[model samples]
Target: MKRIAILNCLKANDVCAGAACLKAFNSRSRHFEQYGAEPIELVAMGRCNGCEVGIDEGFQEKLDRIIEEGAEVCHLGVCTIKSETRQECKTITEAANYLETHGVQIVRGTH
Candidate 1:
């Protein structure tokens, strides 16, 4: 199984139902559809350290740790990218940059 990790939005967690993200990943819909046969093993699911105010302490460290644990791919949950709020966009960008800098392949979108 290919190890993967999800980076979600902390703020969206309060309001979003997460059904779309869950369905897409579980059913291999949207971006997930490209995986032909390899089964995805979700190794970690973490939220953006905090809201737009600022990234939480040790956010980068935590993300790097996920990769160290064998997460070859990191995905941004829908809440991190598709949300209408600008704060969400910032968080997404930040998470993407961090993951990329740490050499983790990023796959945008979950469900």
Candidate 2:
């Protein structure tokens, strides 16, 4: 059981970032919990305004708030990043790289 934080870039393309990200992260978290893995804390880290592709001030704000609420691992699974949007996907990869650099193990949702 690992303490994980799944991060959603939540960049804007069309869909609402907050609700969409929460939905994906929650679904993934449910799967992890079902498998008896340490469930992931869904952390939506990005600008709701869809300004930047990378985790920036908005990202820090969200991350800080979520951390204050006790969130840890980082998973990028927002539709913008994980499914359709290109920049968002890049953010996801960067997030994975950052998390690993920060000493967290980066793995897939199936893990």
Candidate 3:
């Protein structure tokens, strides 16, 4: 079975001003587990951490840790982008391809 992680780019509290992020995270968490993947590990960091800007050592460290342990995919909280600008569904789609090329699939929310 492949391990799956939830990708997020905000501090835990920032995930909620409303409820979209929480819903998306939980929904995907359950979905992946049902499909025989590891329960999603939320990869969140502080606002100062800039996880949204792209790769950083701290964030990369976490990703590396998961990947090293053989995480085969990441199911993003689709609503994450909704909560933020750069609704890069296009950038995200491209990123998914990139991640898959590196042998780690990046999936979107099912619900």
List TM-scores for all candidates, in order. Answer: 0.78, 0.48, 0.53
lDDT on C-alpha atoms for all candidate structures:
0.75, 0.49, 0.51
The residue pairs found clashing in candidate 3 are none
Sort the candidates on TM-score, descending order.
1, 3, 2
Which scores greater on lDDT, model 1 or model 2?
1
> Per-candidate RMSD vs. true structure?
2.6, 4.9, 5.4
| Number of the top lDDT candidate | 1
lDDT (tens digit, per residue) of candidate 1 on 54-100: 55666767787787878888888766755455344776687687778
What stretches of model 3 exceed 4 Å from their correct place?
A: 15-48, 51-53, 83-86, 89-98
lDDT computed for candidate 1: 0.75
* Count of clashes, each model: 1, 6, 0
Residue 22 C-alpha lDDT in model 2: 56
> Scored by Cα lDDT, where does model 2 land?
0.49
After superposition on all CA atoms, how large is the RMSD of candidate 3? 5.4
Clashing pairs for model 1 are 21-111
